[model samples]
Target: MAPIERRSGRKRALVNGEDIEKKNTLKRSLRQRTDTVKKEKPSTDKVNNNNINIDKKKVLESSSKENVEPPSLASNLPKALSCLNRVQPGIQGFIPHGLHSNNILYRLQHNAMGITRERSLRQAVVQSYSDQLANYRILTTASPFDRRVTAMQWHPTLPTTVAVGSKGGDLILWDFTKTEGITFMQGIGAGGSVTHLQFDTTDPSFIYTSSIDGKVSRQDFHGNNKTVFLNTMDWSYWYCSLDVNYRSNVLVSGDNLGNTVLMTRQGEKVWSHRLHKSKVTHCEFNKQCEWLLVTASTDKMVKMWDIRMVSGRKSALYELPHDRPINSAYFSPDCSRLLTTDQNSEIRVYGGPLWDKMERTIPHPHRFFQHITPIKASWHPIHELIVIGRYPDPQFPGYHHGENRTIDVFDANTGDMVCQMLDGSAKGIISLCQFNRDGSYLAAGMGLNTLIWTDVAKLTTQGALSVNKTISGIGLNPNRGSNTSQRRRNRRNNNDDEVDKLKKKLKTKTKTKTQTKTKTQTKSKSSRR
Candidate 1:
């Protein structure tokens, strides 16, 4: 075999010749496999549903030849090889892998549980607190001044006008009767802080502003006169608070010097009381008795005073003791209850003729979580619920990320939190909040901004939607309309006469004064020469 020679005359060993033959055979087998796969790939693309028509007659005829022995192969094959004879391979399902019995059912003599426990809890909520409120919305938070708003009060008869006193000592009156027709005006002074504002009950345009300059000026929008009544000499201390009693035609004002002065409607001092050792933070009159007054101070005492009993310090009726400085002391709308709040986040409700008996003390919803500052609580006009505004106490356990502040409603009687309205902007601390007489609107003063939450549903029913486009042309009632029109006509007549007479008188006086001044100047120049 080692001496073999090829017929082509090239010398080749028998071992090398056999190796070449085996290599050629392996290459032929690989080329055949690749050629067959290429052919099968194109045949798959040529497949069409219409060309493979399934005939029932063919299938029935083929069924009769089932007795024939199947062709032997490496594996068992489906007889017809249809698509239905195959299935998706998975771990478990209604049909088990290789026909195993995993999914099962039992009759159990007709007794059964309809739904699993996990599924039962996935149903709709039964106590839906979201449905209790109507179409409530925060219209806006407006801060017109450079500093935090200090004083705020709503117009007595009108829901549209809210008088806000800025820390700059200017009163900005916002008219939201028609938001598009809103207007504001600067009032009184930039002399000092306008600490408080109280609108007159009988007059829509008449409002009183207390300034830190020791001046309480009665500003009326009805006329051009801003200072109808200004008592500067009597009130030497900055006026901290002011309240008007329309029935008694009197005004009660508390000062930073702990002096509470009772003034008549004409700004005449009727009486004065100086018993508090600290500044009077708040003062409010009882709805039933205009003579009765409750003033809260930093002295930790809420003292009640009657203008009629203005004899001495003995005239002070009752003093409510508090653990911390009292922030607000207000009587309920019906005059049947009294509410007091302290800097320690304590709220107390009192009932009885003199509000001497304590009804309940509401728990702080924020608990021991510390707020950077405290806020006053507002009582619902017709219910036993009070709204307490709070921000997410950063001191809350595990608290790191701050959230939007919330105004929580709580039951005044049971001390349970009811609902909450989130301040989506996460604005600064809320300082003041109050409800209207009918409780249709809530005004919250947060930081330098005033946020008004209006009961749009209740307002719509009351024909607020029918308000005219004119800022002051809302016809709320026919009687009020007629009365206002008459008063306006009379005021116009008086103003016209006064302006004409005063203008003529002023012109004549100025002419005379200028002539005299000119003559005096000429003489002085001659003397100098």
Candidate 2:
């Protein structure tokens, strides 16, 4: 019985030990599970925080991109106004007058505001005209047989008279103020189309005309005499263009056969030279009688020639090359520069020293498309501005389809475009355009109607004061007026003159006083003796 009780106690002890082991195992498993749960919670929180950070970075990147774009139209207003103020600061609130058309006769008064101070002050039309039908007063008209009026010119001295040249070779002179049909002057057949016409600056009655037949004729408006100054037979081909100097003694003609002829008043060829591979389009003489000839050819080259030394012989002093065929060329008023227009609607300028090497070549600043071909170019008489005439565009039809005749102003110094004027309704092509001697009037011949733009006063004033200030040192300070410097200069000159006169008077008075004193002393000495 004792052995049986001991075995039961051992069995109970073993069972209790197994139960304690099981409890320890359960506690260890619970701790392991708790530790695993803590580690998982930290990893989940880290992933969620990283996602929030990525979203914030994306938002910042989007905001930065938006800030980098260009400013909108509304934002540019201040900048544009600032630029305008910088360009024109004087006379605040001075509004510019609009160009108004009264019938086809547009009267433009040359405003005195823009001229350089040294030039003489004159009020003239930067543009004016009269035509035949009397539809437009103060304009010139075409003839019965005239296909188109190619060129027009007013007598340099006779302001009331004007001459019109047509494609039919007829030269008509009209007293613009008269109500009659016109005072027509019958001249010789122009041979081909008349390309250019000019009144002799030296002789008001003498007029010159250039034709495609290679003939340049001089006609006396006062008389019925028409003399051929130059003919194509003298040169290689027909004279396509020509110009006479202010002296009226020398004539320059450009021919279709790439030849330039320099002739005298007696129809004698002074010199002849081949300038380009293509037809010579235009020729002109500088103010000093130094010649600058421009020749445009099918070769797409415009050659500049200086013939100052070879007035008696056929030789060129200098030649310049261009990329396109030039249709017309004009020299600035000072003759320090030249401008050439091409068939490609491009205008180029070359600096000049009469017969020396060219200084530089500059392209026209205005953007002109290929469809708008420039046919004629003329320089303003007093200002460094140019007028370009665009020929009819073959692609476009009807009035709207035609090339709009444009007159653009450029800074002769910087070649920067300043302003542009256009003819909205006029059709046909502009064959010739000229600025009158005063630079206040511009005359243009279009098809059957001759259009004149008068009262160019705004142009005269637009840049005149600024140019004057720059050149003459006027209006430099806000407290000082333009007359201050001028008055100072005048005072200095007057003081110098006064000093000179005082010195002269002192010498004379001293001589007279010395003579009188000498006589009195001699008399006194004799009396004392």
Candidate 3:
């Protein structure tokens, strides 16, 4: 009986050992399956976390590379930027005006809230115009000359009429109102190129052309008759720049020999001054102040002269010196500021009343080379904004490695880049750009090709309101301001809101995914325990 019991106990022990082995094998198989699942599918929380980090890095990199300030960031962020920065920070509540707004403490405390009424009004107007900056579609393209286009101008009174002068001494008068387009085309230069073009102040039918051959020609509207208006006579000197004052019908021209000649509409020289040691690159008369004349020169100086106090080279009324040769100088629409572009990488703004001090210096790339025309900064006809052709430099802020050269618009007051205008039609460097009388149309000259852009919204609304009047060139509609401004504001706000909502949704989705993953892990661990 003992032997039988011992055998039964041994059998029982063997059965228990088999049960233990079976449990171990099941655990091993389950572990293997779990390992394979883990290998095939990572933990969602970790994966989602990695993806969020990657997305954020990509967003930051793209933003830095593009150099475009997203409206969400620009409008919502509290920035400690300079007071001169036109971008207002996202500050809540009313801010008191400070006596010294430029002080660091005031700038930190006010964040653009301490702006004066005049400055506020000016900025408001500039902002209103800035809102109209949509991508200007290429309205038209034309090859008006055989050689490079050096000068372009829109008729002061005729909205559709434009004149372009070429390096081959060729002139083309184009009227967008006509189907044939070319109203006049002529070669008015004897041996040199046409340097500048200007329209007569009182007569839209007459135009002025200056040539490197030392001749300024006046042509009738039809281009049938050309009269040699002003001949420098000394075949050595040539007119380089020309501008006419519409108020007084007084014309001003700069010559390569550093002469700034003021003339009457009758082609008689009022006075000539040796304004610079080098060639005069640009001469302009203030549209608002007829007697105020400004001249830029290759001698690295910009000088302002009041023609009323005219004398021989007896020092300019006010002079702004530069480190590099000045390419062009222009007065603001209100004649309260002067904008000058230099051959090197600098653009300067001189404040008005007394033009002695340089208000701001904006760094820009405009290296002068032989193949390209000198880049000249121009003023928006009605706003406190500046426009200039951008030289393609990898180091330039908005320039990409392989992108086409663009036209840059800047805020004259704040010295901030406002926007860039680019299109497929502008394949070459846009060396010249000009705004029409009311600033509704813009024309740019690229090599020999001419590109024109009209405000899309303005054109559309005008077409819808009075198609016949628009076609007939009646004028701008005065009643379209309020609704257009409101629409622009609404669109801008909607865009910002949409971008913000998308960002918020992404953050929420990540949070939800992480929370769900954590909860699932906790439940699985509890069940295992």
For all candidates in order, the CA lDDT equals: 0.63, 0.55, 0.71
Q: What's the CA RMSD of model 3 in angstroms?
A: 33.4
Question: Which pairs clash in the backbone of model 3?
Answer: none
Q: Which stretches of candidate 1 lie over 4 Å from their true place?
A: 1-135, 177-180, 187-191, 221-223, 228-236, 365-374, 391-404, 455-529
lDDT of 3 at 326: 88
After aligning candidate 3 to the native by TM-score, how far in Å is the CA of 18 from where it should be?
A: 89
N/CA/C clash count, model 2: 39
The TM-score that candidate 3 achieves is 0.62
* Candidate 2: 10-residue stretch with minimal lDDT: 129-138
Residue 270 of model 3 has an lDDT of 82
lDDT of 2 at 194: 71
Candidate with better lDDT, 2 vs 3: 3
Candidate 3 weakest lDDT stretch, 10 residues: 467-476
Against the true structure, candidate 2 reaches a TM-score of 0.51
Better-scoring candidate (lDDT), 1 or 2: 1
lDDT of 2 at 527: 100
